[model samples]
Target: MVDRESDTYSCECAMFEHMGILCRHALKVMVHVGVCRIPSHYILKRWSRDARDVLPDHLKCYQKDSD
Candidate 1:
């Protein structure tokens, strides 16, 4: 089963309906169904692949650039 707290799943249906994306709860269900990888369509907001072109490009703080 997908962990709502740890996973990207949201439990708000209205949010999902308005956004046409899976809420955390739905994501959990999808995880339970054995979907190890989350598709681009399932994510909501600007950080997902759908928003890749729209969102600004920024380096990850956790990543260290190689010399």
Candidate 2:
């Protein structure tokens, strides 16, 4: 089963949390279930071509240092 929170989702596979990107398991479930769009928070703007664009308001200050 996939576990979902307000801004992120995970599966027992845990690859996204470990790698800072979507896991294969998550992508498979999304495609199989016809989830057409990724939740905004899950999109890493740094990976986008327009990486300089500011994160949306709800996601502001959402990132924290793991240390």
Candidate 3:
């Protein structure tokens, strides 16, 4: 069920928790209810376009290897 007040959208299948994305059922509800924007809490940073923005330089392996 799509809980707008609490911003907790869920289905019995529990796919959102495992996969970190809204399931088809939840998506359908959002569309049907005319939800224009997805809540930020439900969005995963890694899945977003700026996923790499928060990464450290070393983690991104930008440094050259020492010979």
Candidate 4:
């Protein structure tokens, strides 16, 4: 189900809740509703291309390697 007011979505598949990934059903709903982009909250940092570029404040002391 898509809740426009809260910008939340749910599916009987429970893929997002279980795997932290948006399911095909949810994607279809988003497309049908004309949502051009996926919300930031749904994009896990670990899954992004720049995931390694960012570190928590507590781990900031560590530096990334050039190679």
- The C-alpha TM-scores of every prediction are 0.38, 0.56, 0.71, 0.73
lDDT of each: 0.58, 0.69, 0.80, 0.87
Candidate 2 segments exceeding 4 Å error:
3-8, 52-67
lDDT of 3 at 51: 76
lDDT tens readout by residue for model 1, 8-34 = 455645566676756667766776778
Q: Is candidate 1 or candidate 3 better by lDDT?
A: 3
Report the C-alpha displacement of residue 42, candidate 2, in angstroms: 1.1
Clashes of each: 4, 0, 0, 0
Instruction: Please state the error at residue 39 of candidate 3 in Å.
Output: 1.1
Candidate 4's C-alpha runs over 4 A off are: 53-67
* lDDT per residue (tens digit) for residues 5-67 in model 2: 453457886777776788887787778866789877677777785663466767655645212
Which residue segments of model 3 deviate by more than 4 Å?
53-59, 62-67
Candidate 3 local lDDT, 1-67, one digit each (tens) = 7667897788998888999988889888888888898878889988987776676866766534412
RMSD of 1: 9.1
Screening candidate 3 with a backbone cut-off below 3 angstroms (N, C-alpha, C), the clashing residue pairs are none
How do the candidates rank by TM-score, highest first? 4, 3, 2, 1
Question: Could you arrange the candidates by lDDT from highest to lowest?
Answer: 4, 3, 2, 1
List residue ranges in candidate 1 displaced over 4 A. Answer: 1-12, 19-21, 49-67
